[model samples]
Target: MFTGLIENLGVIDSFESDRFTLSVLNTSTTSILSTASVGDSIAVDGVCLTVESFTDNSFTVTVSPETLQRTTLSEKIKTTNYVNLESSLCVGSKLGGHFVTGHVDGIGSLVNYISTNKAWEMTFAAPSSKIQEWSNFIEPYLITKGSIAVNGISLTIAECDVSGNWFKVSVIPHTYAYTNLHYLRPGDLVNIEGDILGKYVEKFLSSTLKSTKDRQSNINSDFLAEQGYQ
Candidate 1:
């Protein structure tokens, strides 16, 4: 699990087939490499990748086929050289952001971005080519004002359409300058993870409703009246 708070930025040193090597950009501060060890999990662009090997400044991970299909990691290798990185949450660490599983649901793209006086309002939408995947995995959980992890950066939905086709987030200057969001452009792909709580609630409610519909109740109004004095 993670808090979706980005710790450092990493440059993609090399990506070939399933193996990826990323060099930490800022090692002076608390970085993923500082405590990284083989078999440790790290959030790379919101995807939880296991550390297969590491050095003082760089680490390597192998991407599974499922992760590649669900996230933008493969696309990122071609389009962007930098990736947002965050270490897994420790037991006693402060929960600065929302609970992020680092399990990306699907990929979204930057629709547009505008600079406001205080923040940068960035709009994102599901790519037309991957509309089905977006609808199935991402669209259902896009609640206005709800938490979401975009490229591993935790953010709230500033606004969203009723149909859930698109959503926007207000990024403060600090986050914009510190993370990889500053490098994004229109049509750039990003990994997206919806609030895990919302997904759990949906699953529970759906299952409960389904079970209620399938079960035959023994007590109707007639039966209740017969059993009770009232």
Candidate 2:
């Protein structure tokens, strides 16, 4: 799990068919290398990647075909790019952001950006059909005032409508200056991991309801009494 709060912006030193290499390219970055170890989970642009090895200021992880199909990792490698990085959340740590699983639900592209007196507003255009179709899997967790992780950054959903199947987020100057969001441009793809709590709640409700419906007798007091219901 993660808080969607980016700890550092790492640069892609190199990428291959299965292996990826990243290094601390930002001098102002404060993420500690000593605190990391092999086998630990890290969020690389919202996609959970396990650290396979480390040397110097760089680390490596192998990407699976499924992850490549679901995230911007492949696109980034083809374009030779930098990526946002965050370590996993630990107990007793400050919850700076919303709960993020580092699991990309879908890929979205930057549509536009504008500067506002309060904050920078950005819109991302994704496959409307997919987001709406997956609403059953994601909507219950999304409250009007709840949170979501966009490219590993915790952001609030200013507005979400079914008609456009799109959402918008506002970024303060600090987030814009400290993260890779500033690098986003029209048509640039990003990895999106919806709030984790919502996913679990959706699953639990669906399972319980489905099971109760399937076992119709399990719902009646008479049937429950046969099983020692009090």
Candidate 3:
């Protein structure tokens, strides 16, 4: 699991079919490489990818067909791109951000970005035509005032509309300057992972509760049979 806390900004060095070569830039270079290794999982722009190879300055990983279909990685690679990279969390480390599974639900287009003295308020539009397919990742994860991981950076869901396929997030200047979020354009695609906790809660409430209810009903039926009631 990841914390949606970006540790390094890695550039796309090269791409060959489904495989991508990345080079870590900036001062975190050594620290970022230290914890990383072949076969280790890393979140690249909120998409959990396994390292296939690595060196002091660079690494390579293969993107699965499902990943390509669900995330913005394929879109970002059409040109040179910088991705937010975060290594998997270690035991005892502070949970700086919410639980992020590095699982991209679907892609969204950045519709607008407004800069103010305080922060950057950005709006995104999920495809409206295919509501279910477009919002599948976010629908389960969104809660008012709760956290969501966008491009591997954890941010709270400031607001969402019940019917509209759009939401807004307010980004502080520090996050904008440190992460690749600053390089985002109005039309850029983003890999979004809804909060992990929300997903688990939903699963438990939906499946586990149903199972418990069914078992209780069966028990009640057995009790009635023992009492000679049909």
Find the candidate with the highest lDDT and give its number: 1
Model 1 ranges with Cα > 4 A deviation: 218-230
| Of candidates 3 and 1, the better by lDDT | 1
In model 3, which regions exceed 4 Å deviation? 27-30, 128-130, 208-230
RMSD of each: 2.9, 5.0, 3.5
Winner by lDDT between candidate 2 and candidate 1? 1
- Residue 52 local lDDT, model 1: 92
lDDT of 3 by residue, 1-230 (tens): 98887888988888898899998887363457777778899899999989989988788999999998888888778877789988998889889888888888777778889999999998877744435766666666666688888898999878777754778888999888878889888877787777777888888899987888777445587789999999
* Candidate 2, position 10, lDDT: 85
Question: How badly does each model clash, as a count of residue pairs?
Answer: 0, 0, 0
Stronger candidate by TM-score (1 vs 2): 1
Best TM-score among the predictions, by candidate number: 1
- What C-alpha lDDT does candidate 2 achieve relative to the native structure? 0.79
Against the correct fold, how does model 2 do in TM-score?
0.84
